[model samples]
Target: MKNIILATTALVATAGVAAADVSISGYARFGATYSDNADDWNTASRLRLQFDVSTETDGGIVFGARQRFQTEENLSTGGATDPNNSNGARFYMSTNGFTLAMGNILGVIEAAPNLYLPTASSGMGLEGNGFYSLAANTSSNGGRFAWTAYDSAGAGAVEGVEVLYSMNGFGAHIHSTEYSYGVGANYTFSGYTVAVAYEEWDAAAPGGQVDGDSILFASIGGTIGAFDVALAYASTEFSGVEADKWSLKGGYDFGTGLTVYGFVASEDVVDESYGIGASYDLGGGVSLEGGITQTDEALDDTIVSLGAFFSF
Candidate 1:
């Protein structure tokens, strides 16, 4: 499998040399995860290869496309499968401060500027799954938050368009789909970035009527001395139902290739959750990371993960 990946990488890089720039990069990680609720230890790993290509046209417009091939190692099978599909392909055209993208594009809210988590491991064990509550036709699953502006990579090829513009430390994004639309803007000044976004989805409910749901998000991030800090808030509304969530994250860099970070969050339906973690740069595109997280809803429920990440 490793040899196959290497050969494919070489082939991809060699095929795009004619009047274009091509880059091949990827990430991989292997880790051990422990859950107190399950009382078991599990292994998790993921590999992703990114193919990026771009060229400047005669008219000075930049044209580009990107695709990612990913494989998640399943512990049950002890193997991974790389499916050849175009679900992750995205094309773009850009010049000056404006850019246009289509096909598997990110929604404005999902692409909001400076939106990130400081955790070394995936936060909350939900990975944004239970992060918000929006009205939709899908099963409620016991009333947990379960809606997002857009689906993540390899979600089986969606069609959308995104337009973005940036100038003088300010940027705006707009994305539209058949049933959903979003818009956002951000500005950076004095080492701080502030952004806000809103998105709405028209979902199909019973009786052939459309149910509208929306989300609003705001975030701010900046640096203070050796500490980096970020705060965010989100509110969702649908069918006279309203919910809100907020989180605060901070990280401190020791200037010695080691950093520590932590965060706390509160949501309307879920108990408050918090985590602390640290990462060390091993150099040469490798890093060591680990974290521990807990939620107050469970009895002795905690998750701990230790992982090594490789990037190239």
Candidate 2:
């Protein structure tokens, strides 16, 4: 009987090893920043770590988990700690070209359109810089639930669902449903890609006000004789809002690891903002980047930042 128990334990250990795969990946960034206005100017830095683990069953179902840690710095105090930091985990499964994810995840459908560009920022300017839509308000949270479906061809379209909840911070209350749901689709062909998404916030406001917002985005990118060029556009609309918001971004890569990028965005209800940046790769997983940002409303608040990133 003891031998039988020992054999069962050995079999279980082997199975676990056979079903599991793990990887380590992260990036570190350090730089200096300057602002023309009163926002302050100083050194800037950030570190992020991500862990991914996965397993596959004999039935062709895949399961995995992803966790990340993010940290930032304070420009005025030169302190390393800030409340904007975040740490979270996500669990997901995939089978038969369908994928499902839950637990502290980004809103898939709502955030998809904004992620169309390859810029370092979250493309916040595209939607009136946090004015027309409440999407930016839910940047972090207690958790989120999501689902996705895709074609096996890899270049086909994808559809997804996202739901979010949090009990603290700006909008927190049992009666106030901080939930969102939407559908999105993306297609790629000949070095060009396009995506469209729409989302509705059940109770995005504080006083039980239900607000709905939608975003439309498209991008085209390709290589042209040792240079890479990309162009992107986004339009945003909100419920009960009279004007719409839009943004345009362009970038050119010199192939020698140097690239230039710029963006201009505006909304009729708010002032306009624009930025220009450049980046150069130093090889061996290191790169240098710098950019300048200005807004019409905050004329004195021009920001210039330079930073380096290392990935492994």
Candidate 3:
């Protein structure tokens, strides 16, 4: 990763000192995972490279773009090129507390604050958020999206616009595609933060009624003593099926470069999930981490994984 950054910088130097600032950074991860359900042990690894370019115009507007390239391997698939993981250029303009972005922009609902849990190993080490599913079909959750433009099944690079504003301890975000729209707001006071968001689709099927979906999410998070805690709830209606989900997560820092976190969430009727994990910072942008996750199944279906992460 360092070599890649150095080479990129050298190439950029040929431009003879441009106004834009360019930087490259990424991470490499390798882990071993065991799943009781599959009754097998597996290995996985991944590498990602990200480039960020930004510049300020004379008009006091900041313009920027972010792009990434990644490669990965899993026990089942070995190694394969995943073009979908590579995002196209996303451009943005920002000033003061307001910012506007377009092209490959995250969906409003998916980008809403406090929607996903924050953890060192991303919920379950190598597995990562095994059961924290959301209703946004445009997200990685694999749900069905009612908006044609925002659907992951569509071809070509995603196109959308998002507007964001933040002032004092308050922030708001709004975004839309051709057939979908969403709004979100968050506020921080004292040591607590609260957020809520809503999103809906406008697709009308042949039956004369709106055939799309809508989602509402709310969350609160704060630091209490040595632990950081959060709770979130979401209600969604997709294709006539309505489901509600709630999750609680917390983390503690030992002040010795070690942190532990855990979460439990339930949705629908029989769905339940939980995970616990810890990470130790080894310094120099490296860490060792491990975790276990159990889904709504028999106790034997749990999954455990351990891994090392490197960032540059």
Candidate 4:
């Protein structure tokens, strides 16, 4: 019995050493938000947590998992327990410039390419209304399945996927629904990057009506000195109506933890909106940020927001 226990202890130590290559990292974001239009405002505070774990095998294969959690104040229901929440998990593998992910993951076809750009004031361009905005495309949720591929030379890449669903009548019945495949590609050279993507959705309408939609988008961005700039254009075609939109944004770093940024955007069907924002790093992974936006449609209506963020 003493010899058996000694052998088991040695095996456990060996296993622990073998698993030392695994790594874990994550971040948390919390902030407060207040809008000028209280009726349109939904929440004044929010919190989110994200975690990632990864390991590399001896044969050069890398695998990982990511999980995210989010909670926010429920202003519409006058309290916090109104079920306004979201969570998701994702798994991924990669090797030799090629990568693939599955499960409730963010769409690589549309979301991944833009992530290469640096964030402005801890947020994305257009103040969270980047390519993934519901205003940019009617559907915000991604397809059920997604795939990604990259060139061995690492100069270009592509991604595609599809989604399927069948819903019974609640107010209307959807016999069959599918968000068809999408493809995106990007090329980089000498500090400049260009990307383009397309997606299609097919839906069976109420009372046997058949209709569908398609979206196309392209963007280019680059950096110089303490300044960076980006321009993006997108088009959406649904049944009979079509809309086109574009935005331009740039920022300049003044050094010593201060930066200034500005953005302008317009859609064929909506008034032009423009805004400028600034951020000051308070040191120790904390920063102060604020911005104001104005639209031509409502000359008297302006949106303003300010907040602070600290990362551990």
- Report the number of the highest-TM-score candidate: 3
| Deviation of model 4 at 131, angstroms | 8.8
Question: Can you tell me which runs of candidate 3 are displaced by over 4 Å?
Answer: 1-18, 75-85, 129-157, 204-210, 297-300
Question: Positional deviation of 302 in candidate 2, in angstroms?
Answer: 1.1
Per-residue CA lDDT of candidate 2, range 1-312, in tens?
Answer: 245336434544554333778998888777776757656667666666678899876655566777665565642221123424444466665555555555544443434433433544332221112211222222121001111211111111122223222222111111111444554555555655555554455544322224554344444455555444444444444444433345556577777888776666565555776777777889998877777767546243676767777788
lDDT of 4 by residue, 208-306 (tens): 212455567677778888998878777766555677767677789998898887777676766676767777888887777666665435333455555
Model 3: lDDT of residue 311: 87
Q: Which lDDT tens digits does candidate 1 get at residues 1-312?
A: 245336434544554433678999988777777778889988767676888999865546667888877666532211113323223578876779888777778777666654556433334221211221111211212222223322223543446778889999999998876666778999999999999988777764221223577777788899999998888877766664666767777789999998887777676645666777778889997888877777546233677767788889
What Cα-based lDDT does every candidate model obtain? Answer: 0.63, 0.48, 0.66, 0.48
Better of 2 and 3 by TM-score: 3
lDDT winner? 3
For candidate 2, give the lDDT. Answer: 0.48
Model 1 pairs in collision: none
Q: What TM-score quantifies how close candidate 2 is to the native fold?
A: 0.68
The alpha-carbon lDDT assigned to residue 249 of candidate 1 equals 75
Clashing pairs in 4: none
Model 2 residue 300 CA deviation (Å) reads 5.8
